[model samples]
Target: MTEPQVRRVRLEEGFEVQAYIYGEGDETLFLANGGPGLPSLYLREPHARLARDGWRVVAWDQLGCGASDRPQDPALWALERYVAEAEQVRAALDLGPVHLLGHSWGTWLFTEYCLTHPEQVKSCILADGACDIPHLVGELDRLRSALGAETLAMMRRHEAEGSIDHPEYQAAITILNYRHVCRLQAWPDSLTAALADWNMGPYGEMQGPNEFTYTGNMKDWNRIPAMGAIAAPCLVLCGAHDELTPACSEKMHAALPNSWLKIFEASSHMPFHEEPEAYFPAVRAFLEEVAARAAVGGLTRKSHPCR
Candidate 1:
């Protein structure tokens, strides 16, 4: 694999973030990783491999994670601020109307950015992402419910007592993670590293303590109503056993005016890691379709949405 070239890009309030660039091509695929708080490492490494296929791939650490400057101001963690910051990063790098890929929390940010700044987006890929937080929370609850009445009760007790770090509670979460988060008996090193160094400030404030809970500011957020207005060619990718769930992807797919949906049957949240042979090709095909469409003038809402 080729090494990515890293650079420091300055954001508002003088905050600087680390950006990585792979390959060199006219068309760019910009990445917005999940975890409002995770570094770009996990998403960057795998997708960076896509650069070999003749497209520039760019990814960055958000304001307070990875090698980015971590300011202690709580005010900087808002979605609106992050959206503006994403725009700044694109503008500074001079990547024109990139193919945007948002995983996990990044899907929320990129979806909003796509809506607000349509001209700056060529296409969008929402990987293991959902636009309805309330619905997503419900899906999470359903997944947890499979642990049976006894385990659920213990989890609830720990949650109520703010002992989520307790062994029993963590053990329960571990099972669900193995089943829905990645499904691989052993997680990729890049993913493990990203989680190891994860910054939980924005995560806790915006998305709660863990993947299965929704006590954050965005718990009630729902963007489905506005999804129909998104004009960019979009691809919605999710695993059957994803923590975000296929139902969430289906909902987003139903609302997006110009989009395609792909569900990896035997995988989970991190399908790119769990089923890369299938995942990468799906993504590559989508990018190829977008590029081909762009070549014939430009894409339009009238264009047939793939599935």
Candidate 2:
């Protein structure tokens, strides 16, 4: 792959974040990766391949992670602030009518952005994410409970005591992660890099201690009631065992008026990483269909991929 051109875009007067631009095409794909605190590396590196197909791919580090400025202000970690940050990034980059893709936490951000600024988006991709936090918390409880009463009790006990760093607790989390997060025996370098530099400040404030926990400011956040108003054609993708859960994707798909859903049977949270052969093609097809529709000034039509 060609080296991505890195650009620093100012979000405010003095605060700037890094954005990686790939290819030079008429159509653009703006990516919002998972992790309230992760750099855009994991999503950028893999999605950059879309550049080869004549699509400009743009991924950025949000305010508190990656190459972005990380201030100590706790108030800046809110979802509303992040949504505004996304708009600033789009405006700074001059990405016109982008095909927006949000993975995990990015999906929550993506749904909110589209709700707030529908005119700027050509289409939406919600991958391995949920828009309903309360429902997601319940789903998470279900997933963790599958570890049985003994393990679940231990996890709860540790969580109650604020001992998540304990080895046993972490070991349970690892097992759940293996089953529902990546499902890959070995993770890709890009993913590992993002994990290594993860800024837990924003994560703890917005999401919580780990992927399975939801004791953050956003734990009660839900956009399901507002999803129907999003007019952009949407593509919802999830792995059968995603931590976000396929049920979450289904709920999103059902709520979205113009949308389609796909469940990757052999993958988990990072289907793009776990099943790229299937993942990339699905994303490309949806974007292509949307672009074609825009080109002809036709109404957005649903492009269904095999379930």
Candidate 3:
């Protein structure tokens, strides 16, 4: 696959967001990455394949992460800003009617964007999806608790002492992260770089200090009630061992009238990294079906809400 070209796409907000563009296919997939603050490069595992397999893909850092601008203003880290940022990126690039895809926290932004701007979407993909922030945090809490008493105690002690950066705390988090985040024997360098480059400005203010906590502004964010507003055919992707959980993806599938669900049984949150054998094939098939549907005409999204 060709290397991603680092490009600048100017948003409506009059600021340019850094992005990586790959492939030259007619069908463009706009990626909304996870971590309200994570660099978008981790997406290369799944997306680079899409580009090589004949699809145009655009993955970018949202304002404050990766190669993107880092203004350090907390006021710019709200949920709405990211949603608007996605819209601006699409518009500035003139990437007409893309197959919008989001992973983890990115799913929340994708959902809200589709609801508000249904006209710009050809299809939607939610990978390792989460619908309610409270539910997400609760699930995270359970995952942390299941990590055994000693590890949990170490993590909690560090949190209580405000020593989240303590080596003990970091070590404990790695144990938990290895279980639910990647499950790979060794993490890919891209994912490693993403963690190293994670912008605390956006993460701490929006997603919290770490994955198991949620003291940020998104604690009450819930988009289930607004699922009907998306009005676009969707693909819900999740791992059986996912921290986001299959239930989260199922909730979206049930609510979305024209939606399908795929679960990678052997993987967790980062299925692309953990279960590429299943993850990539499933995604390719879904996109193929989407392409076939588009060739015939367009997806007729359901007009009613889930009851």
Candidate 4:
């Protein structure tokens, strides 16, 4: 694989976000990553195959995380701001009608962006994402219970006291992450590198300390009811054992009129790494199907057919 072309995109005067462009293609895949804060490093390999197939995958570390400029204001971490950052990146690069893909919290960013800028996206892929946070929290309760009564108590105690760094707390959450987040015995080097460079600013303020404990500003976030607003062809992807879970993906699939769901049976959150055999083929087929329909003139909203 060739080194990505790094470009600085201006969000506003004195503020520029770092974006990495990988591969060359006629179709553009603009990726919005999760973490609400994670850098784009963990994403390098997942989309490389897409690039090889003539899909230019563009991913960026949004402001306040990774290699992007960190802003001190908490107000800067809102969903609206992230949407705007994506728009700015699109404008700076002049990437028209991209096939947008988002993973985890990035899917939320994709949802809102596609809702507001329907004309900008040709199609969308939401991987391991939920349109309902409340439903997700309820699922977390079930998952935490599976961790045994003792571990649940320890996690709750640490969260209440704000001692998120406590060893016991870390231990419990690590179990949660290991079982659901990735489920790989060995972490990929790119994933480790991205994790090492994490900035807690945006995450703590938006998604809270960890995956299970989402006490941040987005706690009440739920878009399932309003998913009808989305106009693009959407492919909803989720793992059978993902923290985001298959049920969450089901909600979005049911709500989006022109959408379908594909499950990675033996995988968790990061299916690209966990089940690349099934992962890439499913995604490639979906994108190709959408592109093919588009080449013949896009679908009409009156019919709004599901794929």
Q: Please provide, for model 1 over 1-307, each residue's C-alpha lDDT reduced to its tens digit, 9 standing for 90 to 100.
A: 5798888898867989989999999999999999989998999999988888999999999998999998888778888899999999999999988999999999999999998889998999999999999899889889999999999999999999999999999999999999999898889999999999899998988889999998888899999999999888888999999999999999999999888889999899999999999999889988887898887865554563444
Preferred candidate (TM-score higher): 2 or 3? 2
RMSD of each: 1.5, 1.3, 3.3, 2.2
Q: How well does candidate 1 score on lDDT at residue 168?
A: 91
* TM-scores for the candidates: 0.97, 0.97, 0.91, 0.95
How much lDDT does candidate 1 score?
0.91
Off by over 4 Å in 4: 297-307
Model 3: per-residue Cα lDDT over 72-167, one tens digit each: 778998888888888888887778989988998889899988987899988898999788877777788778888788888888888888889998
lDDT of 3 at 48: 83
Task: State the lDDT at 150 in candidate 3.
Answer: 84
RMSD of 1: 1.5
lDDT for model 2 = 0.91
Give the 10-residue window scoring lowest on summed lDDT in candidate 2: 298-307
Q: Model 1, poorest ten-residue lDDT window?
A: 298-307
TM-score of 1: 0.97
Q: What are the runs in model 1 whose C-alpha is more than 4 Å off?
A: 297-306
Candidate structures ordered by lDDT, highest first: 1, 2, 4, 3
